[model samples]
Target: MKYYQKALYDEMTSFYLITCDDEGDKLGRIRSLIGGLVRKARQVIGQEGDDKVRIHQLLQLFYGDWGFHCDPEHYFEAENLYLAYVLETHSGMPVSLGALLLYLADSLKLPLYPVNFPTQLILRAEVDNEVAFIDPWNGHYLSQAHLQKLYEGAFGFGAEISSEELERADVNTLLNRFRQLAKNALIRENRNDAAYRYIASLLRYHPEDPYEIRDRGLVLAQMGCYQAAAEDLQYFVDQCPQDPTSFLLTAQLAELKDHFSELH
Candidate 1:
């Protein structure tokens, strides 16, 4: 079972949460596969000098040898977040694949890191006094001009990208992005039960998130978990007490409380 860590959203743990059930019945197999992959990666870099650790080598290993690539068919499917699915099938959306690749890079002591790009995940590392960026989804170099083109392509001509958008993202941002991917997929498929679980996971890592608190409460109520719904709504109301939406949420929480009391 993935012992729920309420502190920070860990990469491996988050993968476990998405891919496996709470019991994680299949986690052992997943871990074994990951161990073997890392071992192979380690062997691939055996006794090589730091300069030899180039992005193309990584591309060859992950894409050519390991065969990891984007799942174009199910680009945003919630199942792509499952690490086991990615390992076995070698396909996922950018964030999942990027996150896993970044994690593996870190494990191997590579300087690779995740970057913040609008609606897309990317990787970057400092090499020889210059920063190198890679698009994990396709293993292509991500230059500034390319990033601008990608931005405008995804978000019309008026939308532009700058240094602000290219900053390196932290763990919390990665967690939110990961949760958002699954949350969006679940909500799209009308899987409120699973969506609520992901919302709960988001709150664990970011308890002060007012939007998530409000959304989670709404989802909880939809799933007939009245008490939890009320608590989450109340938390949201407390966090953003000045927000006009909180007043409406307050009324809803009051109604939910009354319903909960009668059921006791």
Candidate 2:
């Protein structure tokens, strides 16, 4: 495997292993699953040298035969962010699906790379030295116009999809984006303990991130750990004293202190 691919795989697997105990066995199963996918792709993809043809065949195997697609109704569910659950259910949000699709494309020797597109995860494909976009939610190809429409839809119609925005996401960038989505999903569902664990798992990558510290504090507060929450919020306030949200968190910090005193 190339260095970039190996690094990405390691980061993805390690992130998942944070939650589960049976690491080796689970990794083995995931490898077996990828192997099965590769075998199936070979059977259908044939000896095609054309990148586009191979991409199409791989898409057929994945979305058509494997039934992997986004479940819009349950898009925000925490299960949609994990690879194991995504593989089993064949349904995931764009980030999870895009990561798996990117890995599959690489295994099949297709020139697919992750695009950390705003509000949507996508893939950038290079075929015959020409760059194009593919929506990992479905196999549909994306034109620049379509990309503009998506950007406008997400951020309102004025700003365009900049060249920088279409640049390929590096391993850490991709992993962090996916992790953030998973954490947000957990928080939205009021799964405070799970959110806390998820944040702890990701903290190693960004030990001193004030945003994460503040979020962890909020999650702790939700779980009734007022003292810990107070400490965290205080850290955030200290780190970012001028931030607008710091004012609100300062108020919350007082309440947490009050609660801590009551419990004491």
* TM-score: model 1 vs. ground truth: 0.76
Per-candidate TM-scores read 0.76, 0.89
lDDT, each prediction: 0.73, 0.79
Q: What is the alpha-carbon lDDT for the whole of candidate 2? A: 0.79
- How would you encode candidate 1's per-residue C-alpha lDDT over 1-264 as one tens digit per residue? 321222122554564664345677767777887778778877886535673365567668888887888877889787777777787888987877776666567666566767768768887876676788888888878788888888998899868887766766765766666666666677776678778766776678778888898888887887788999998889888889999999898789888998999999
- How well does candidate 2 score on lDDT at residue 189? 82
Best by the TM-score measure: 2
Q: What residue pairs clash in candidate 1, if any at all?
A: none
lDDT score, candidate 2, position 61? 82
- Runs of candidate 2 exceeding 4 Å displacement: 1-10, 21-25, 46-48
